[model samples]
Target chain A: MTTIGENATIYREQHRVTYYECDQTGRATLATLINIAVLASEDQSDALGLTTAHVQSYGVGWVVTQYAIDVTRMPRQDETVTIAVRGSAYNPYFAFREFWIQDEQGEQLAYITSIWVLMSQEKRKIVKIIPALVTPYHSEAVKRIPRLPRPIHFEADTQTISKPYRVRFFDIDPNRHVNNAHYFDWLLDTLPAAFLLQHDLQHVDVRYENEVQYGHTVTAQVNQLPVAEDGTVTTSHVIQVGEEKCCEVTIRWQPTTQPQA
Target chain B: MTTIGENATIYREQHRVTYYECDQTGRATLATLINIAVLASEDQSDALGLTTAHVQSYGVGWVVTQYAIDVTRMPRQDETVTIAVRGSAYNPYFAFREFWIQDEQGEQLAYITSIWVLMSQEKRKIVKIIPALVTPYHSEAVKRIPRLPRPIHFEADTQTISKPYRVRFFDIDPNRHVNNAHYFDWLLDTLPAAFLLQHDLQHVDVRYENEVQYGHTVTAQVNQLPVAEDGTVTTSHVIQVGEEKCCEVTIRWQPTTQPQA
Candidate 1:
């Protein structure tokens, strides 16, 4: 197994900030930040010499089970931010990964940890994480595999919250799954663009535990108000399938960072 | 007119190199590059403070009547490239803009020139460039606006070639027109994926002169092929609408700058 030492492989995702990603409010939005984080994941996989085909070769692919991100500060439009990621652990079922966003000074501004399930691409059903496939990463900090607690007392709060959406075909990326950033597209579209554009989602603490199949129902049940901070509301949402928790997203929004003149 | 000096605008576009744009070949796919160029055009409009809402307020919106671009080099994966654009000319009938793409070292790689029409977005018909809207950029330079030749030599080649495609609703971006990148998607999809992945398309020279309404049939006609220094084919094609030249595309393939690794 690969370990993070002088010899362990660590992938660094380097990038600079651009204007288009910034809104009238200057800070990078949570959606945009998630998009960048996904890129870092791809880059990390590339560093492992894993191409798109390699991921698909197993007849399975990684689906973001969840993203829990904490942002201490958001970079401005012209500023640079780097996301570095490493495959932290893997069990029989899920591969655990940790990601960090740092400024030019190397100060970590945000951290995100996520669980990924191996799934059959064609059937879109969860598959066991092949021991051989994930066996290589155990050498690096093989500690307790942090179980992403299915939100305690987590209930969809409503069986009638059927958030109907037409899945855009192009939303399916080369990986043959909806690009994880697109999940925000599904969740955010329920809000007005004017409200979304003006506010910045500062912290995203989400747990994705289940897979939503193609041509199936995606019902987002907002359980409750998770937190209230800085004049914006934070809601806890879980996509459901009757008795099972498919996915959960907790988003916190605050005033957008003002744009630079 | 919001002139930088005496010109309404003397400007450069956002040079972006997002990794999400590159395909398995480690180069930005033709479709992604074209889409970014479209974003550059949108940025130009945004900088001019001419938003879609602002244009719609006048009962007209500028629709891409045509586009012709010649790509001399395809930027490598993760390389930032710039597109320089300027107003070529404008009249009561139509408006024209010219653009060029360059590397960080200022080496020109792509040249694009397009014609746009102020159209009523509601009724789907052509109209004149709004005078109040045109007043801002029309100057002495615009007075002697050059009649850069439109896509010519259409009547000589009547041999027909046709391909049918369904326009996905997502193909329409925020602008409500089919995203310009979708044109490249249509163009490239006609060829075998193996042909696209194995061999590099080094140069693309294309011109757009008309609009393809939703669900319109597009026929790609190859008119000529010129031999290249490296023993590759340079194909020139024109997409036509009966008697009208909608677009002309000149592609030079097997460019030498491809990464061998």
Candidate 2:
């Protein structure tokens, strides 16, 4: 972590977007964007000497529960972008962190606000945030957790499209669970390919309810809301393993001219 | 491309393996290793003014047909390794390239030899190597194609385990087809997780026979051979889209103590 001001601690890293990270439109996929943000936070934690192993030694691991992302534009292939992250505030149970991506010109491309909680590896339950575990980066301690906008629940009356996906071995991280970023792939992939090509994702609100395991076949259910007056489209998604819901996501997209394939 | 010695052109890049790229045992996945090698070759192509877009302008794009990989050990998470690649030789219809991974101490970890051919975008058929495109890499032109070891064909009598995978949107690259590296995931994931955890991959020979497109459900069929005298196990995999075969792979593994998950 680098000190920008007298009290502000920020961690920034430069990464060149590779072709494999992009989709058919030459823009980074939603999962790739989220992965880059998570990578930046992990780097920050490493710089603060609060590595994953160190935290695991305390019988807890950091797990993301929610993310609110606003994208002005997705990073393009071969573009060098900067990812900056900082721990903002924390209460007894939840920690709020912020991440932003910027192009080489310093223009911000996306901003993400995320909520994290300490989870007991053995118990598989949320644990209270230990003060010592998050004290190194100097985040403020607060009594009340911040209330961020939550993803909307799936509507019963809306028409839905569902797809089934079996979790692969590569989807499992070292923590023995599917990584959070992979949920985006399962969510957005249910949409029509033509719709994905003609639209640009503007905002996303995703909430994780339960962890998905390897070898499990999960169903992604998606429902598209009517286009807004301003020509933007909204969609709600639910990921489930059998009858148990694992994640919920709401996304807004702005239609663009058809991209040349 | 950098000149290591007179008449030798090489491209090398350093990458720190992130935790997301590793499996539960903290070692990089087969797809991740192959992706790193492909990234190095792409970087070399970019440096030599043979960018993908430039090649596509001629109505053709490079496609990998086969890969022969030998791994001493997979790189671990947070380990910075160097990936080096160079064009070795080319024929009228094929190009041969070599890639290797090295630790910080310069000890080699993995080596890959790949065969590439130009595929016409319109006809979707193999095209002869253009002299103008091959001249920049300075690889020797040979009349005879190199005879690399081929992946063994699956036997009809052998029992096979099959898993079906629907290609997702993110699986498709800028070329509008699933990237070749993704085949490794489908092939390796068919093995029992316990088997994967108890073995270390030593060598692999994969041959790509057809391209897989988005929205296709491909079945991965895997069969294991009897253990050899040296305690090595060999596995054969075939990826099929309905009646058409897309890929074939053979992998050799050495049994190790069960990894601590």
Candidate 3:
């Protein structure tokens, strides 16, 4: 496979898709793809001296705030794939990172842009971006970092499909919080199985507003937008714990029927 | 680390645990531990000539029937560990395998014994084990293979806690059945969080009797026996889809508090 980068700006890691990581289609699921990115980023952290060991020593860590993912295709199980991540930019409040996946042939399959913030472990409060943390990674300091597209607003009175979702202990990560990827499971699974089987997910954009803890039961609410003339579809989702909105996601899809066969 | 084996009889794979594989305690969870063994066994299959490609070509695959796990310590996240698996024996209907996990310093952390059966992909029926499939691994055949200890039966009239668990899409493995490891989550999560937090799991023995498909809503039934004088506790669990018992598990736990500081 061609190298993702030949310089210090980009970090890349190769992963072989395992059976347990794939879905019924024999392809990696959205959560699995996001996990690959997370793994690669962790590798980069280790390489750049911001290893978990180093960061935890200071009683601080990074937490993801939002993510926007775009997909062209899904890799099948056992396919060796590469994930490349780059620190895009950072300000006093937020840092931006970009992640992309490539097939064994070095063809791009999917990409994700995520927003994160450094937080104090003890207080669980956001902290300023320390100059030392950013300097070691050698990331460019842009005047303005790009943000995910604004979610389209649906009619305020529209009814939504809702399902009860309970957070299980296994969903809790080492960070003592629910892993962000699991939000996708609650969001997507809320849709009808027939809808999922009849359409292919094309894009996803999500914003995490609150952290969900173990033993918390939340309601997953979904609303489908009007279908376009070309048969494309969009859906809006929200996960709420009582009256608190924990997260929000918007997804786009295309019909599964082959074109001009 | 010391070598696991120098011959084909034992298959070994080394892994550095990632952040998501760990729990709040920074240690691997029961499901993650089982997943590591499954991954190593898949590697062995690939190395010993029964790769997924080869197995799929014959329209048959191996399915676990039962597992008995003994744990002395749990590896923390980022720790490098090795999983070694050995094919013990096989008859016309069953195959026995053994798995063990070791730390980087070569200390044994956990061990597991599992039973498996080959099932045809189309008919979903058990198939005869061909000698060619087992000969490449060169395992020793024995007169008889011991089974996991039977779970202590709970009184039918006794009150038990039951939780509704709906199988999510991601829980389904590539084989179209619920992954064996996920049963641990459903079984353990049914317990009260306070009980889980106050105790450390000691041992687990489980038998897989029926397959749970995606979207199947099953009731997780848990029965806790009275704590013994020495602070040992045993719990019996059964996962039932309607009236059919899907699986059974018995777990032992010890209070986290020490007798004396």
Candidate 4:
């Protein structure tokens, strides 16, 4: 097994936010933000000699199950930001990873914590975390799985606005499944354009329950919760493939001081 | 007006292809390839002090009307490639730009030629090309407008496979219109997954007819043409919003030596 010092567990890279990565507001979309964080972890894995091919050689591949993200503000186009990731801890079946984005001045922009599990490629079942896989990152081995926040429960009777989407071919990643980041697009896109343009995302909790395949038609259902005393609004979203729930997400938003033009 | 020497017309930047930029075959998607080329031209504009903001200061913005791309092969994930763009020539109403992607060994991978026009941001009408704008790029001022090949006419009576798509919020750019690259996704997604995995794209001719807006439900219609004697297949695509035709594309594909697993 490849070994690394504990101090080298964290990996960081600088990236210039390009126009295509941003939305109409000139700010990076939530999906792009999540993608940047995921890429950071992949970079860390590459640096530690634990490439995806190496991990899959044991007939298993890593898959993210959940993510809880906190954002101060979305990075704007043309801004150069730093993305950092570190393997935090791993239990028998789950691995915990942390990712953060910072501006050039080192001010934090967004923080994300994610849960990943190894799945058997042949049987498509969760596999036990192997020590060799986690050791190179110097992650702590713990018996107790950490409890991250779960997405707010979606009420079945609540009034909702939904949008149906046909999975595009490009949405499939190398694993031949719709990418996790694309889920964010479908979830957020169901919201009213006015609300999306007027509010800034503060927190997001998302959980993936089922894999979505190409050519599958999925519906993104969203319902807004009562506004908090602080004027913050929360929205709950679920992506469904007919009767099957594919993913759920809850997002908190604060009104922007200057709404997009 | 900022005057650049003719020798400085070409601009080049190196980019590392990331996993998120690739599809199931581990090759960069057509939309991502086009975006990279557009970004390269934007970088060139920035270098010449002819930034988008500077151009928009005159109440006009550049809009790409057509693209003709020829690909040798798609760049693979994790490969570092060089993207280069040059402002070739311009007339009273049009600007022609050329872009090319090269592998690490400097072997050409793709070449794209595009036509751009300045549009009045307020009136949304085509504006005459200002000499002050093209002068900064050192593009040749010519009287004749270059006649590039147009996308093959899509016959109305041809049987087509069609897919409907809702324009997502993230699809809009800072200009509040669906970005040009997203159309490629809608155009190519209508093809069968088996065909996509077995064929390599050789050429793409796309022309944007109208801007697609947020919340618009668009349909992508595609029909295959007879295969060439050389076994190359051609497809014609049209993106429509109800009765309005938004964009048209014609793509040629050659069977791959090894189909994707």
Candidate 5:
């Protein structure tokens, strides 16, 4: 049993700097950042005395539902970054978690927050987060968790894709919804790598609107995030593209999630 | 919006099962079983009009936390199976989902359930699940999820692996957990494909225990799983055939993740 405090300032931490995680600029892609979130989450779960069996004993398993992230920076090839992650709060049936990304210089780079749920394995239904399981970590949380807004998907008025993109066989995962990380590829593919590196994500939330089946394409688009009151930086996404309605989204800038330290 | 009707059931839904999801028996794997679940969920999410972006807006992303399944049955290559999935429940922060898999002929194969959590994007922390977000899915749910006991991970830990497993550039995923589906290759590498298809996975949960470096050997042992559960199956793996533990794993057979129709 390893304790995160021994490695991270706040909790258990993991560091990685794989070459494949970067582009020409050596910066990590948003998709790669997504991967970081996963690696970190798995690390944190192992630390919390939560075993696969312990989680399964309840007749349910955890699955990522959605994510909203703010990436201030991206790591480049061979550049190691520290992923500091911790658990936040939950009702009785969920496991809400948080993640922080920093460079070797300890420069803050990205922040991620996500939602998860428990489902019945046999009946294949959603179940609640059992308190007895989460109580231990709820008390050990580092700080307060903020509430995030639900995304407004435009599936009703969304454009129908005519040209189905040739989906790669490798994109599929154990759960098969095009590995969530691949979303970065479709997203960043719309723009030049240089543009992606120069601009970090301030805030982003993309609710999964539909499935992009193999040999079937989903329209991709980008548009600005709805403007905020203080006239703060705005958000934008490649509003609509592709034929299937899979859009490339980008937000102006909102320093939410991971803060600059 | 689309919804999974409770009382209304589809006796046998024909599915065009893909090929990449198979094991030595030429069938889908338990790890890939999750991918199958994802496909059905995406279809269901779309039926509900919830796009990926829409889910992201909530600042919470859903990710798998736990899972329990008996491989008493699994679908063979090209065998079509019916998928029934629905929203179970979500309290403040987590959403529970369920899935049922059967053969085209309507035979039970495996039952699985999982839990997910919601978190904040800006603060990178867990947050409450707002009913407004989960209200869309109208289905019966449970407060507690069932859990499965994980088998004991090998204890003779050693990390001197140097055999050199090439980094299949293709094997890497966006969030990079060594694509769970690829583990089969490593496991079956030493044996003939004929020898591998003889049994099924009753249950499996590997910790990844450690990362297999970009150019290192990933020795494995296949002793534990098929034993007393049968006891005839046995295999041992170490960094070097005679070495201690660099990586250790056990596998058992019951039926298969893909059940016959």
Candidate 6:
């Protein structure tokens, strides 16, 4: 079993934001931020001698089930940022991870918590977590990381806003599935452009239920929730391929400041 | 006026393919390859002290108008590839560049020829090429390079197949417009999956006409031509945003190997 100690490793990686990673506003996309975090986690796993090759050798792979992210500010293109990640803890079937993005000045920009599970490639099902799998990695459980609640179920019959998208070849990642991060783009794009332009994303909680493959046409539908007194608007999104639910996401947005003349 | 010289610099840069840059087939996407080429060109410009900031200081930016790419093979993820770029020649308003992608062993993977025009950001019009902008880059004009012919104008009423796509937030680049490369994905994805899977992209010729912005719903229409005796199929794509024609692309694909038993 992995023992908690001061010698546990916290992986750190620095990346310069590329033009392709930025959005129209020159800020790093949410998907890019998550990818940066994943890179840090992958580096940590590599350091522990648990690389993708090692996991595939055992006929299993790690899959993130849920993520909760909070952003104070989004990094801009050409900005160099650092990501620090650590395996917080693990239950029998679930492992928790925490990720932080900071600038060169050491100012925190974003914080994220994610839940992951092991899956058997042959069986296409969740596998029991073996003690050996998590023991080698540093385990320093975080006491107050934000918990991403289970995605709220949404009924399509009640949804008033629906957008259709076809999965392009570039959407597929090395894992042979539509990247989980792309779902954030699909969800946020479903909102009205006027609303999106006037607001900025504040927080997000998402859960992946099924994998989307290439050439699939997915429809994303959003159900608007009540607005808060603080001028925050919330929405629940359901992405579906035919009758299968691919994923669910909930997002919160706050009004953005108008540019001064 | 800039004079041709033997002392000009041919800019080169190396990049390792990331997971996000690969497609489901584990090969780097065509758009990703082109992005690598652009990075090399940008590096060359930056070295010449003609960075974006320098160009914008004059109220102009370089925009690629046409590209012709020939791929011998696509790079795989984790493969470090070098992109060497040089300014081959320039007319009064158009500058030509040549790009080559090779492995550490110096084996060539792809070669590209592109035509760029300086555009006034304020007036949104083609501007005269400045001698100072093209003089420092090497001008070893390629003796023979594939020329991208002007796209045959297409009548919307004649197009038989049309695919709808929204300009997602991530599609926007640092220029605040839908990236020129994303148009490649939108065009290629319009083909039937069966045809795409059975064939491999061998060459591409594209021309960018209009800039797409956030919230634009564009339609990509494809016109398939007769197959050649060598089993090569060609298609022409026209992307339109409402009544405004956005871009035109012509792609040729060759038959690929059958699936392994």
| Per-candidate chain B TM | 0.74, 0.95, 0.90, 0.95, 0.65, 0.89
Tens digit of per-residue lDDT, candidate 1, span A224-244: 353455476665666665566
The global Cα lDDT (0 to 1) of model 5 is 0.52
- Every candidate's fraction of true contacts kept comes to 0.01, 0.74, 0.69, 0.83, 0.00, 0.77
**Residues B1-261, candidate 1, lDDT per residue (tens digit)?**
223214546457756565545554556667766666656766677677776678889888886656656666666655778877665567677777777778889898777666667888788688866766655543223443444444434333553334444443334444545565666655555444444555666556556667665445566565334466767765556665566666776665673444432
lDDT of 6 by residue, B144-175 (tens): 33356776666555645788888886787876
Per-residue lDDT, model 4, residue B154, is: 79
Candidate 4 residue runs with Cα over 4 Å from true position: A1-8, B1-8
Over B1-261, each residue of candidate 3 has an lDDT whose tens digit, in order, gives: 212223338888888787777766677878889988998988888887788768878888888988888887777788999999987777777778889999999999998888888889999899987667766777544445666677765443356888889988778777666787888889988888777767777788888888987888998989998898988899999998998888888998988642211
Q: Score residue A114 of candidate 1 by CA lDDT.
A: 78
Residue pairs clashing in model 3 are none
Candidate 1 error regions (>4 Å): A1-9, A23-26, A58-60, A105-107, A120-143, A149-163, A192-199, A209-232, A240-246, A254-261, B1-19, B22-35, B38-95, B100-111, B115-140, B144-261
Give the winner by lDDT: 5 or 6: 6
TM-score versus the correct structure, for each prediction:
0.58, 0.95, 0.88, 0.96, 0.42, 0.85
Count of backbone collisions in candidate 2: 0
DockQ of 2: 0.71
Model 2 alpha-carbon miss at residue B140, Å? 0.0
Give the candidate order by descending TM-score. 4, 2, 3, 6, 1, 5
Considering DockQ, where higher is better, how would the candidates rank from best to worst?
4, 2, 6, 3, 1, 5
**Which candidate leads the pack in lDDT?**
4
Q: Backbone clashes in each candidate structure, one number apiece?
A: 14, 0, 0, 0, 152, 0
Candidate-wise lDDT, in order: 0.61, 0.87, 0.80, 0.87, 0.52, 0.80
Docking class of 5: incorrect
Among residues 3 or more apart in sequence or in different chains, the pairs in candidate 4 whose N, CA or C atoms overlap within 3 Å are: none
Best of the two (2, 6) by TM-score: 2
Looking at model 4, residue B64 earns an lDDT score of 91
Using TM-score as the measure, name the better of candidate 1 and candidate 5. Answer: 1
Which regions in candidate 2 have their CA more than 4 angstroms from the true location?
A1-8, A156-158, B1-8, B156-158
Give per-residue lDDT, candidate 3, residue B186: 90
